[model samples]
Each structure stands twice: as structure tokens, then as C-alpha cells.
Target: MDELRAQLIATARAMGSAGLNKGTAGNLSVRAAAGFLITPTGMDYASLECADIPWMSLEGEARGRRRPSSEWRFHRDIYAARPEVGAVLHAHSPFAVSLACLRREIPPFHYMIARFGGTTVRCGAYALFGTQALSDAALAALEGRSACLLANHGMLVAGRDLKQALDLGIELESLCEQYWRACQLGEPVLLSAAEMAEVLEHFRHYGQQSGQQSGGKTS
Candidate 1:
């Protein structure tokens, strides 16, 4: 349990270092034995200790000195809804926020769009932060996907564990920036549905044969 907490903390700090988040603008959580361990609300990642992370049940009861992230409801809901997801990350990265503010869906301008489990990254319907309404919108946007943009907000991603969640958060931000830049050059050409389908199928076997969880986390 201590090791898991340490991993979660390290990933939370990495989120800031990787520029996927700033200050207390995002949250991360990993599935725990009873529920999940999440970064506390309003705490600086640099100052986080294992003990500072809170354990909260899917039912919403919490344990630890600190309170769970204000967005804990969605983390809980994601875990409840997606059995394969072991970690969840939410970030307010600039590019994602910009596109989200426009309520835009990132079309398949690049084959990497399939990396997110779809040909387009859907932007969830807008809702106030930290509310069930937001969680509902997020879940809807995330249908058949591992990542989605929260309208007028940022992005949310899930992985089999902390490492993948961190990687996806970074990768998703990069994709958002790339898409934004492409848009500035005029409407970018999009891949056909058939093309994206080919990429998706290829992605299923894109990596090693070693048994690993989704998003490329080996352990």
C-alpha cells in the first residue's frame, strides 16, 4: 500500500514536471484495495507525501488527513464504470483547455487519434467543475474511449496504472497542441473512417507480445 501511494505521488509530481498540469489544477488517482488513492484537493504536488494522499471508497467515504481531490466523484465513477481502468488523470493543460473552451472534438487529422480509442476525441457537454453533472458529461464523452476533453475545462484520461495515466496525459496534451497548431494552418485534412479503422486494428498489436496493461504500462 505504501509503495502504491509512493507511485501515485511520483506520478502526480511528474504531471507538473511534464507540463500536463500546474499547481493544484489537476488530480490523479489509482485503484486501491478498498477504493482508490487520490491526490488531495488544493495540495501542491511537490509537497505531497504518501500519507497526504487520501483513500476514498466508491461510495464516497474518505480516509486520511487530507480531503480527496474536488473531482473525486468522476474518478470514482470512472473506476466504477470501467473495470479495465486502474488509474485516472485529469488535467488543465493549456492546449486541451483552449480546444475544450471551443467545445471542439479533435477529428482524425492524425492517425494518433486512434490511440485514444476513437477517430475523434469527443468534448463533453459543459458543466460546473466538481459536480455530478460534470462527471456524467465526462462519462458520456468517454464512451468507447480512454480519453476525452471536458468542455470549457481540460482533459481526462484513464490507464491501467499510474505510469500509463501519466504517459497518456502527456501524450494527449501533445496531440491537443498538434491539433491546435494544425488548425491554425487552415482546416487540416482528416483521415477517413476506414483509415482510422486500419490504424486501430494495427494498434492492437503495435507493441510487444509481453502481457501488459493498456497504454503500454508493463507492470
Candidate 2:
């Protein structure tokens, strides 16, 4: 558990340094049998430590010196609704948050976005933090997808583990940026449903087999 906590802290800082999040605007969590370790509320990513993180049960009870993030409900709901999800990442990234403010769904304009396993990314209805309503809407929006944008709030991404969840968050933000840029030049070209089906099939296959071992030759 100590090593897991340390890795999460380091990954959070890396996300911060890479501009995925600013100040205390993002939160991360990793699942455990009893509960999960989550970043403390209102603490800047640069200053996070293993001891500063709080452990919270799936039911939202806490056991630590620090309080969980104000959006603990979001994390709890996701874990509860998606038993397969082992990690959750919420980020207030610029493009994704901007799109959220507009309350618009991110359509699958590029094939890479197909990794999300849906034809479009839904935006959850606006709700205040830590509220059950927010959690409900978020869970509903996330049906059949690994991620969703919280209306007027931010983005939520989940994966089988911490590293994969963080990677999905970054990919979602990049897709949002591309969508916004394409919108500037009139309606963007969207992939047809048939095309998206093929892409999704490829995604499932790729996900099933861990591709390209790290530090290994590409070819």
C-alpha cells in the first residue's frame, strides 16, 4: 500500500507538470479491497505525499488525517457503478472543461478517439460537487464508455488501473482540443457509425492484448 501511494503521488505530480492539471483542480484515486487512496482535498499536486492522501471506502467513509476531495462522490459512484474500474482520474483541463462549459458532447471526429469505445462522449448534467445528483448523472453519462465530461465542471476518466486511467484522461483532453480546433473551421468531419464500429473492434482487440512492451523495439 505504501508503494502504491508513492506511485500515485508521483503520477499526480507528473500530471501537474505536464499541464494536465493546475493547482488543486484535479483528483486521482486507486482502488483497494477495503477502500481506496485518494488525493487530499484542496492540496496542490506539487505538495502531495503518501501520508497526505486519504483512504475512503466505496461508501464514502474516510480513514485518514486528510479529507477527501470535494468530488469524492464522483469517485465513489464510479467505483460503485463500475466494479471493473480500478482507478479514476478527474481533471479540470482547459479544453475539456471549456467543452463542458458549453454542455456539448464530444463527437467521435477522429479514429483515435474511438479508443473511448463509443460513438460520442456524453456530458453529464451539471450538479454541485459531492452531491448524489452529480454522481447519478455522471454514472448515467458514462454508460458504455470509460469517460465522460461533467457539465460545467470537468472530465472524469476510469481504467483498469492507475496508469491506464491517467493515460485515458490525457487522451480525452487531446481529443477535446482537436474537436475545438476543428469546430473553428466549420463543422468537422465525423466518422460514420460503421467506421466507428470497426474502430471499436480494433480497440477491443488492442485492449485485450497488451501492445508494444515498454522499451522494446517497435518493429
Candidate 3:
């Protein structure tokens, strides 16, 4: 349990190091034997100790010295809805936010967009943060994709594990930034659905399709 807590903390700190988050603006969680260990709300990840991480049940029951993030509802909803998810990452990355503010969806401007499990990355409908409505909206956007932009909010991602979630979050911000830049010049050329369908098929075998983590993430 201690090791898992430490790993969760390490992953949170890594987000800071990579600039995926700052201060306490973002939250991360890893599935636990009982429920899950999530970064406490409004607490600086930089100063967190193992005990500072709180455990919360899928039923929304929280246990620990600190309070779970206000967004805990969605975390709980996600775990209950997606059996394969081991971790969830939420970030307010600048580029993603810029596009999100406009409720823009990341289209198949690049074939690499298939890394998210589709030809286009969806932008969820606007909902106030920390509400069940927000979770509902996020879940809808993430239906067939591992990552989605929260309209006028930020980004929500889930993975099979902590490392996968963190790495994907970084990659997502990069893609959003690239797409944002492309839009500055002119409308970016989008790939065909058939083309991206093929990429999705190839991604299934990317690296280790047999026993390796295919897609290696959860929505």
C-alpha cells in the first residue's frame, strides 16, 4: 500500500516536472485494492507525503486525513464504468485549454491522432467543474477515445496504469499544441476516416500486440 502511495506521488511530481500541471491545479489517481488513492484536493503535490494521499471508494466515500479532490465524483464514476482503468489524469494544460475554451475538437489533422483510439479527439460539453453533470459529459466524450478535451475546462485521460496515463497526458498536450499552431496558418488538412481506421488497426499491433499493452490505456 505504501509503495502504491509513493508511486502515485511520484507520478504527480513527474507531471510537475514535465509541466503537465502546476501547484494543485490537476489531480491524479491510481486504482487501489479497496477504492483508489488520489491526490488530495487543493494540496500542493510538491509537499505531499504518503499519508497525504487519500483513499476514496467508488461510492464516493473518502478516507484519510485530507479531503479527496472535488473532482472525485468523476474519478469514482470512471472506475465504476471502466473496469480496465487503473489510473486517471486531469490537467489544465495551456494549449489544450486554449482550444477547449473554443470547444474545439482535435480532428484527424494528423494520423497520429489515432493514438487516442479514433480519427478525432472529442471535446465534451461544458459543465461546471466537480459536478456529476461534468462527469457525464466527460464520459461521453471519452467513449471511444482515451483522451478528451473538457469543453472550456481542460483535459481528462485514463490509462491502464500510472505511467501510461502520465505519458499520454504529455503527448496529448503536444498534439493539442501542434494542432493549435496548424490552425493559425490555415485549416489543417484532415485525414480520411478509412485512412485513420487503418492506423487504428496498425496501432493494435504497435510494439507488443500479442501480450504487450495494446492501446495501453483506458477511456
Best by lDDT: 1
For model 3, residues 1-219, the per-residue Cα lDDT tens digits are 989999999999999898788889989999998699999999998899999998998888888999999999888888898888899999999998998999999999997888888888899999999999999999999897889999999998888899989988999999999999999999999989898888888776665745765554323
TM-score of candidate 3 relative to the true fold:
0.95
Query: Candidate 3 clashing pairs?
Result: none
Cα distance off (Å), candidate 1, residue 172:
0.7
Per-candidate clashes come to 0, 0, 0
C-alpha lDDT (0 to 100) for residue 82 of candidate 3:
84
Q: For model 2, where is the 10-residue window of minimal lDDT?
A: 210-219
Per-residue lDDT of candidate 1, residues 1-219 (tens digit):
889999999998899899988888989999999699999999999999989998999999999999989999999999999888999999999999999999999999999888888889999999999999999999999998989999999999989889888888898999999999998999999999899889988887566567866554221
Model 3 residue 132 lDDT score: 96
Q: Which ten residues in a row have the lowest lDDT in candidate 1?
A: 210-219
TM-score of 2: 0.92
User: Which of candidates 1 and 3 is the stronger one according to lDDT?
Assistant: 1
Query: Which lDDT tens digits does candidate 2 get at residues 1-219?
Result: 888889889878877765689998889998976678899999997777778988899878998889988888878888887778888889999999999999999987898776776888899999987788998998989888888999999998888888888888888999999999999999998899999888877666564446754421100
Model 1 compared with the native: what TM-score?
A: 0.95
